[model samples]
Target: MLVSFSPSLLFTRYNSNYSTMESNFQGIVPASDAPTKRKRPTEAEHIPTAPKEPPAPEFLCQDCVKLDLSKAFSVEDTSNETTKMAFAPGRWGYFNAWAVDVGHRYRGTIITNCNLCQMLFNSRVDEGDTKLDGDGDWLRAVSFLEICGLVAYKPHRWISKDIPFLMLFSNKNYDLYENRKKVRHLIQQSGYAALQQLNQQQAIPFSPKVLSPVFDLGTFQNWFDYCNGNHKLLCRSSKSDLYGTHVIDCQDQSITQHEPGMPYVALSYVWGQPQAQKAVNDGKRLPAQLSLLIRDAIAVTQAMGFRYLWVDRYCIDQDTPTAKHEQIRQMDAIYSNAELTIIAAAGQDENYGLPGVGKNRPKTRMEAHIGDVAVVWAPKDPQAAIKSSKWSTRGWTFQEALLSRRRLVFTEQQAYFECNAMNVYESFDIPLDSLHIKDRSKSYEYLRRGVFGGNREAEFGRLNLEKQGPTEVFNRYLSNVEEYSARKLSFAEDSLNAFRGIAQQFWYGKHAIHNIWGMGYQTPPEERTSSFVHSLSWRHTSNCWDLSQSPQRRPQFPSWSWAGWEGEVQYEIIDSKQKSWFDNLIRAVSVENQIDSPTALEMIAPNPDATCIFPVVIFTAAVVPSKLISFNPNAASNKRWQIGKYKANLALSSGSVSESQFAEDIHDSHVWQCVCIGAALKVSFVMILKVDDGSDLWERAGIFAIDCYSHSLEKMMETREYKSFRVR
Candidate 1:
């Protein structure tokens, strides 16, 4: 079972309403314990307004209010109680800090409202006084006071007297002042000692403590040296500067031509808008007029003991289209051969620069003192920041990040280090290693236990997919396609170019697969025909197509190929039981194209012009005229179609296909040709327009599927004779 992981899951928001108790509880205490008598203060006396801030000695207050509920409350009262508790003063500020601390300290420990009130009241009570019980009259009196608004209570629990856990908040809406103060305190106290202690117990190294605003050169140098010596892959690749036109020399800060075998750092950032060019002359020194991002990259490269740095704007001669195209072709090698890739993943554009690099760095750490010991809080994970950054969305940066052997990602919160082997965050003490574990739960447990006893060779062997079967290779390609489709491309034409490197990898590398027009590929020579047909079985996911946006068709690209679209795409899985039935239906497949003509299929590799064109293959499959019966009558407007007894869903193609024809075809069966396309989750078929064009080709209409267990359809499909047609 292959488990899919999303960045959203990694940075899931903390649920504050979660209960720590084994059993659910209603927040309300017994009515019998309610105070029967109360003394009212004189009207003339000034009632203190809700405290502007949480009570001083914040840690004490935060530590005192631990709640443990006894019974679950009715849904109606729970809602009412939650609203009433919102009246608590200063709950979102310092009061929140205490709740967060307690939650982190005792994760999954449930506390009831009665127990929580007793804890808070006890903290304020005299040193020798007994602690109030959950049902105590004193607790009820305090609750009454809180309910009456005479005293403010922090709203920490939901209807169930359970307290929800607090995950670190994004800096967007947090109080920076308090956060900064706490961060400063944490840094001052032995550089996140508490976090370090936790990490040590977990056997994960704590993030290196940075006492200064900027990165420490010495620390970076040590890390660089360590990686160079320990990581074989980092040291194995030969250095080359052929891709870039100019590289900044760290020694004299001069712009110079990239020298082969000289190590350099590549800068990956988003180019937000057209900026003034800082072009370099052959002999003249590099311009000092660099953007903040470029300057920071230079500083980082020099600090990391690298004498050269490659930045696209300065390195590639954008003035010459030929030169730019040539450099673009070497994009994969450029990043892969570099010492390290510096990712500016925090801001939207180049002007934002690298955080903590300049003097005006934003404060990201917070600290609070608990007796003699200090507690610190900072953004626990910088991965969220990196994943959500504008840079991650850009088409060019997608390949840059993936191709790079190692990446030092700078985010708004902190820097993170990633490589093929492991991922480390500046805020985390642990480094996560890559393991081919399909079970998500077990993978997490492995991380928690710091288990590094897995077979290294076996784990690393997974990358060499050539040794594996075609299924593994196909699955990897599909995964890449899934991720690539979700990314944005500035220019729609660059879609194929941006993803071409991955195609090249699958083609020339271990997979040894022949690249198709971003639809299918040729695997083993014997299975080439089947592979081509199977690749066409992709479908548009629910969020893939934006019907409002005008669809642009790339030249030489067929409507069947995903590369023809501008959004995400997913392949329909064929039914395992129906796999043989669908395969047997396809008699042959022959792909053909004009030998000298430029087609979309030719651009399926890293360098399109250099890649060989796949001969146009003629597919011979069982074709039958079938009418589509929509499961929902409103599907015409909704863009959904169903066929056969299984009511398998089908995605309609955009452009040139007539909706009127589809409506007419369902009423009169001869217009729809169900061309069998291999099976995965179900028997897959492509519905082609039956109209005769001057040429021998037929336009793709839509894709549909049928269940293996559909006896009537299977029998009907078996009766049809195999027919051959050319796919343009």
Candidate 2:
């Protein structure tokens, strides 16, 4: 005989033992058993009854209902303790243990016996059922419970691979899941189709058309043919002007003469540590020893149907200084004119070959799953990876990447195809329309025009600079320096040499702007004196301006130029909003080039030894009286320099200038000369200085500024006589 178990029977059994158990199992009291008597409250003893809560929503489950109570677990104590524990550890611990056991048993039962749970575990829902409230809600609840570790389910292992098991487990609503699934499915299918197109050498229709992932040789060939046939700008080069002395013949698998205009793929990579690789000589055969990177590049070039490949290690003779210098000068054109550039951005050194180019290339995906959805974690933006790569951080590689017209970047995540018109990746597929392509093309065209001249109208129009003035051109050069300064170079002496290509491009036809040292090149010859002085007003963006902190590695360059520093530099003179008042006050008296020593002009060939030529500029300027003021708020006495009726503050630290001598000057002499003017509005004046040794040569001592403009100072400036001085 089996005993029946019912809520009424259970309540009846526990009703006699505990008064709180008088209610039904649902925590609801029967209407007949509820209190009927009414209690009256006296005027002196007012009683406040507890507020009643509304019934739980019908949509909630039985477990949800139990957990939804405001105070589900509570204890009433009749002891002397003032603070009563709401929940006892021993009592709740037992209930928790029982609940865990019951949940485990239920999970086992669902896994082994529940047909509905098993059927839906790895199955894709139909379109109609996907939107149905009952089906979606139930499936989502089960998935959420599993993800939260409240339930044990292995849908990914036992179900279909295409099923998106994680979608059901996601906390997002049905509409979001649907939209995300559609996009993900499209990307997945496009990736598959791209791989198939490469392997089979067959074209397949892909949706949303912009995806261009090059996984194999066949796909790369297809893209190459399409670009060559369609893009008018991507014209083939004649075999005469290429700069490399040697290039690897992809077809013959041997080194050959580098012919100009020959269609060859160039490799951009990091050299890493010095490797004992064979260099090309005056021979027709390939080197016996080759770096892994060069070998991989050769293979890729051949596979992509190119007959020749240019790599720095084999192409340029590093042992010969003359050959290296000449090649370095032509680096910009070499990369810019390449048929295609292969960037090994993911690799740290030459030993690390391009992924997917060699037999031992590492695979990007892992065999993992979340539910039935085959999870693939790939970089969403390959350009970002390329930018952050070790290759990009190197000084030479920056110009290489910027100059290249088209590039096939091999990143750690995936391959990306980029040209002036568009950038496409394997993981994401977006079609390239003419308008979008044109937008991208215009940007590159602008950069090219700025570096390599094309139509000047578009370039000047974009920058909104006056066509006659070189201010925008100067700013553009500084922008290049700003980026180049942050990059790393192995040899400090190669600083100017590495930047020579870009410098040549910037100063292409401008005869007035001479590439003196590095700073004076941007200034016109007529204004060389004033411009050179203005250019000296550069400040370190990262650290305080200190001459001692400047790197002495390249002492051939002067401390006044940014080329002397090993870190980033920014010019304060380029602030366009500021009205320059010092340009007219200072005049260039004479400019001379000093070679070897500080006091000589000699004709020398363009040799490495002769490259360290410094310009000595002489200027005539009106000197004004100024003083350094202590602006430190914590100082004992609030002292400031009185300029006429207005008080002025020091712009730079006194320590950066004269140290203890600055303090002595402040105590001994109340006068200081104003060397140059700075940003307008605040009307900053750079303090003038005579060397501590009492030499006629002058330098910038410090900076001082007044809060407001004073017409009285302009009258005082007219009364002052101009003095001549030599600047080194």
Candidate 3:
């Protein structure tokens, strides 16, 4: 039995109510007028502008002639409840049809007046196929069978084999069956307003679903309830109090302390083109004129039955240095313990409201009908939408998402719920039992959950040592840093601050002694020497679009860390082939970092034995004296320098100071030193440094690799001088 829903109930303002399912079939293309059976074609011919009327026919194909389309088409009312109605669902058929590679003549006649066929043919013709004449005007009488499951016959075979035919199936069949070899139809906009209403009504009943007309508050509340009650991995313990110190009370329109065990929503958004933010007055009330993004966030928080919303701009006491530093230090905890983070990922900046909340989001899906069949044009990937948004490019938002246990993302297309355990979307239902988290290539949650195996503490414990050999755990950290470095940061100095949460999570989550300057080292005092050297061996990529953009030093940060640079760096983990070279190098004797305050470095350093007074790192290692033979600024990085007699290249880490200038400074002295860190494939990786200000301290000039096959390993080590170097 066909179930018919009242259009008024499905769409509140719809004027056209659905009549009882029409059983009678008349005036929907007479069976006798339908095309007769014919041999299938191998090559598509030019569709003439006007085909002459056919004479009395041969035998007919009953299946093709019996298609009744009037039973499938209907019009729906829009939000205004006017006399004009929008398009609605109609009858649709699904078949596992084999696409044929043939000409147009032998193709059998089927549904000769199909609007779908005409649209498809016309669209294909518009792609500059001059060899095919007749501007699709003749397609008004062409058979649907000619274009079924295929773009066109031979002469118009512009479609690639990998491109799937856009087949439209019945709503029920589309959800019930797996997409295999199916027939496709062209999806066109029959009516914009009508199609938008149709999408809401048609998509109302699926599980893990979102209601139509966007930002239906009740629907969003249900998603939170479901995830809260069902996803064990996303739940926070009652004892946890990592939420922000201050939160905005949505109902009171004021800021207040976040109570323990109370659920609060955090917000992640781009604060594009800075504007002055006034501090909350004595009353603790929110500012009257808030950005649309924050205003929408408050409404959503209230709609989800939560009173408190944590927005960084308002929650943190930005004017107070101590409070700001305290909040910044706890960034990891702030995001991790939130009930869920609301990510405003639709627009360029905070001024643009969240789509579907305060703003009326344009419909992303459109539907139209042909006879009894309905076709739709819908975008399926939510990840693509989020990735394209301006919010994804910001440096701070990276850590915000990475630390959050659950995130409710609002993109222009739709809203979606992402957690370590599952992903739910507003557009349609996805069966959770069949979903494998690792298979989501575009999802950040996939990377988040996979890195720590859904339990950060346990995963950290398991990877603290290289008992059986090196694990991918450390490599994952490097991969994340590489991505983070490429992202845009509003202030270059905030580079480390933005990535602090991720760094702290790894540094202090389990074995504290394993991390130094955001790089991973092995545990135990004996193993750290080699791990430390390996961590320092990262190199800037040579294939960058412009070398000037990267390899630029962040003067405030130490050169030993990737954080000291403005761009991406890559670390090739020590492999068995290069183990000999790594073992041959001089081991680090001791390392110490100077910081302003001990409490400032994530409150506590994981390594209690190491000093963390300031941002400078002092270390001692064997250094080799080498002459600066020549320097070529124009050459590619691999052949840019000549150190001693070996062919070498330098990865310059200074953008402000030119290599030519440095060469000029050392022209008469010609004194240079190479601190060999590791080697592989007869190549030695070394850090080049020079005496700083005629003092005992040495400043890193750049990193270089020398071809070492010409000299023996012992010969290379014999020329070294043991010395202590302090780099700031």
Which candidate has the highest TM-score of all?
A: 1
Worst 10 residues of 1 by lDDT: 22-31
> How should the candidates be ordered by TM-score, best one leading?
1, 3, 2
Query: Per-residue lDDT of 209-229 in model 2, one digit per residue for the tens?
Result: 221122433344444544554
TM-scores of the candidates in the order shown? 0.63, 0.55, 0.61
Q: 1 or 2, which is superior by lDDT?
A: 1
- Give one digit per residue, the lDDT tens place, for model 1 in 281-369: 55546554556677667656654546688888777777777877787877777877887889998778998878756332354333333
In candidate 3, what residue range of length 10 has the lowest lDDT sum?
Answer: 21-30
Model 1 lDDT at residue 527: 56
What's model 3's overall lDDT? 0.51
lDDT of 3 by residue, 619-648 (tens): 556665544356777878566677666777
Number of backbone-clashing residue pairs for each candidate, in the order shown: 43, 8, 20
TM-score of 3: 0.61
Put the candidates in lDDT order, highest first. 3, 1, 2
The whole-model lDDT of each prediction reads 0.48, 0.45, 0.51
lDDT of 2 at 184: 42
If both were scored by TM-score, which would come out higher, candidate 2 or candidate 3?
Answer: 3
